[model samples]
Target: MTASPRTPSAAPKTDTTDATDTTEPAAGTGRKPPRRRKRAALLTMAAVVVAAGTSLAVTRPWNTDHDAVQSGPRDTTTKVERTSLSSGMKISGRLSYDAPTDVIAQGQGMITWLPAPGDTINAGGKLYETDGESVVMFTGGRPLWRELAAGVSNGPDVKQLERNLVVLGYAKGLGLTVDEKFTAATATAVKRWQKATGLTQTGRVPLGRVVMLPQRTVRVQEVPGKLGSAAAVNTVVKVSGTALVAIVQPGEDQLSQFGPGRQVTIRLNGGAEIPGKVRSMTPGSGGNGGDEGIQDKPTVTITLADQDAARTAGQSSVTVTLIGTTVDDALVVPVTALLALDGGGYGVEVVTDGTTRLVRVELGLIANAKVQVTGDIREGDTVVIPE
Candidate 1:
């Protein structure tokens, strides 16, 4: 007999039965589906889904296609080279005496006589007269702060006294050990020093009895103490080096570019260029000791490598050129060739054998319209630049 076609209403019950057959039983029931799906069928479904997605993405059938826009030859180009690059700034300076150093009084007495401003005081010589007595300078590694007499504490002050006595010819037969401790021989040497300096011959060396300096001699700049004034721990005189120096007041940022012994070119106001080196630097308010921040540049003292040239140049305003930054044997290109990359940072467009590529580079100092670069670039490589 022929079977009658199933009515549409039977479809719902058939679908429900098929769904129940496919679904697994609830948890803890331990009941599995009536029929297991074929492993090949599940794998095939997953692969087909992935393939369909990939095809849609690759084809993008709904979108319209346009002609590719080709990049033409650059309007300008440059060759990368290995060379030294540096950034520099021209700084104004002047040939002037360094700041006056205060000759502070070390002892207490009446100021009897002062040295003339133009006088020069040598080491181991008298600095000034106090109450008709000389406050003499003696060679000492340390400054004398207390009485160098017997029963005094052992310190460098006592050693300085003993050394001074030996040099001054007081310890002839005493055989004093120039150590940091006081001995009877040291006291005897002090007595001899007191007698020579026209004192009461007390076997005690008092503080402020002498002034010590690192140099051999100093040119007297000024004598501020007046005759008959009480000699205390005040600045008695002002002095400076006899040699001329170029003073450069560079701002804080530029100071980093300079250091002791760095070479420099000094252009005097009278139109002369001299080779010099940075001798020293003092960080503070350059003038008047005001509250001017970095604007008040530190005073940099530059000494001419040639002493005769410095003397000839004389004291005047000058311009100094200092080396600020330097990179040697570096890959470099024109500043214009540096390009802002689409992702970030910087890059250059390199043209090699008619083929063009973008190369990222690390940038360094920019000097004289050229920039230092490093990276996938090589020397003699042609790079594209804007006109």
Candidate 2:
């Protein structure tokens, strides 16, 4: 037999109850709750929803609303000011003497004496002893290739010898003219120089009697021959200019960025920094075999402004920083003040009075944790940063 569908009955009505009420209806009681209690419960829930929305509005991060003003301490702020900014490129280098040249022995004699490394030799100074005779130092561009005597052909080497004699005060009364000719007066001057230098007065300059270099003073860098060794036609001593210079090999693409007289900074191994300038640049020997795609590197020489300070480091590796393009009298700010906007580009928060607003800026040279900024930003304006 099929069952008949029962009719649904309406729910019992009662007055509204307060949401805070914890009382329950008595067992077997037919009485319904008042409608006021139900209304009160809904009103309480609505109040809670409104309270949560108010909290979110007050605690939002980085409020963009222009009408709102920030309050409390102002420690997270910085000022924009006019300053100079430049980019730098650091290269590894070594501190050492300049123009290292080999002093080769040109005579067939036994080495009697050799100067210790680091010894300074000036014009008219004894470089080393050969067969009980001293080989002197002379300032000239070319070495003495042939024996200089009264019968030798005129050449620049003879003039170099005559000039050295005049500088050493040996040609004061000889009336010797400094020319490419080895005249009789030059022989007399040579004799006087030989007598004063404790050598035989033969009035003739033999090959290997003097070591001609371009500098007025030279520092001995190495002594390759021993005291008792034969002074063969080989490098007896290595010498260099007295001044110290930093040598660096940078890529060929950076050749135009460096030149003579450009200012630079040198950081020594001891963490001390000193000022320097570019002294010279030499093009590198390019080849096709080595690194296929890489170009040859050029050599750069830097001279320190403070020679006394540089001497303290001796021979050691250092860092050479080359200053690149510079922006002078530019509006600058700390790098931390920059903010990346959701839309493309960058901006900084400008704090005026107690309010903050984003000001778009165009970036320039970034150096030393500071950046150059432009576009509507003025010097002395305060900018905000995150703490």
Candidate 3:
């Protein structure tokens, strides 16, 4: 009995498996054991990884500390700057006179003489000759509608004539008062003017003897009348001011961007640039009958600051740049440095002492590839641009 008890047989073989076992079955056995616990553990690990990634993206842990240094190449970074930013658009334009007026020939006569193009006629100067008689220029706001005689009614036309006579030294010693009246003094001054200019010493100015213009001086641009042709009431010549201006026809949407006194730039054909300012804007007829449905545009007039510089270009095509919205003393950075944030905003990578951090910013005028930025940044702070 002692010998039998000495070697207690090993415990009977049992077909039980450990509850926490995860070992795969033997190869080629084709046995697919339940693996729910394994799958659940793997899913839990995946959820943790996803949560960490989300936190990293939203929180931007690298930029959490302001004092941290960022390492980046010096050439890939730019400094925040303070400067003036403006939005502008360039359009084709013509460099020519500011205001062009047609000189119409009144009464009937033979056009014996005509001023050549580019001829500058001043106040009281001869404009043309009809029937071998000089047609003089008069500086007045209104045209001479009737013959200037002693019995004519008092009006601004008489006052304009008196003023011209006074300016031209014809009213000297005549005690002429520049009022809206054709008195004896005015008639006497007219006679003096006529005698000095080789005209008949008539105390009245004939209707066809004078042409009124607003400007004191004008440059003749064209002569529609030919010598020896019979002159009927028609446009005899075209004239404009001596000063040059740039004319641009912009879209209707651009009307608000231009106005009187707004500064602009005029680029000449030779690549020279000059400063200018808007002088006036005229509502255009938009598309004409022959335009085939072209859009309507407004005509903008710009005056050059330097008339001498513009005269060098003469009547030629030019480039006009209109400055629209502008911001002064703006903190700016390269547009390429902006980063799209996760929660719908923009940010920039600010680098300081070899460390970089994300900085939230508010955007403003974007011009010439430079963006206006305002945030927790200084003018000299370095911002990294993605390579």
> lDDT (0-100) at residue 70 of candidate 1?
22
RMSD of 3: 19.6
- The most accurate candidate by TM-score is 3
lDDT values, one for every candidate: 0.64, 0.73, 0.73
Q: What are the clash counts of all predictions, listed in order?
A: 2, 13, 7
Which digits, one per residue and each the tens of the lDDT, describe model 3 over residues 189-292? 99999998889999999887999999999999999989888776888889999999999987655676677998888999777899999988989775664667
- The alpha-carbon deviation from the true structure for residue 282 of candidate 1, after best TM-score superposition, in angstroms, is 3.9
Task: Please tell me which model should have the higher TM-score, number 2 or number 3.
Answer: 3
Which regions in candidate 2 have their CA more than 4 angstroms from the true location? Answer: 1-85, 287-296, 324-359, 367-371, 375-387
Provide C-alpha RMSD values for all models, in order. 22.0, 20.7, 19.6
Spell out the clash pairs found in candidate 3: 69-354, 69-355, 70-354, 70-355, 70-356, 71-354, 286-296
Clashing pairs in 1: 106-208, 107-208
Candidate 3 residue spans exceeding 4 A from truth: 1-86, 286-290, 323-344, 348-359, 373-387
* TM-score, cand. 2 vs. native: 0.67
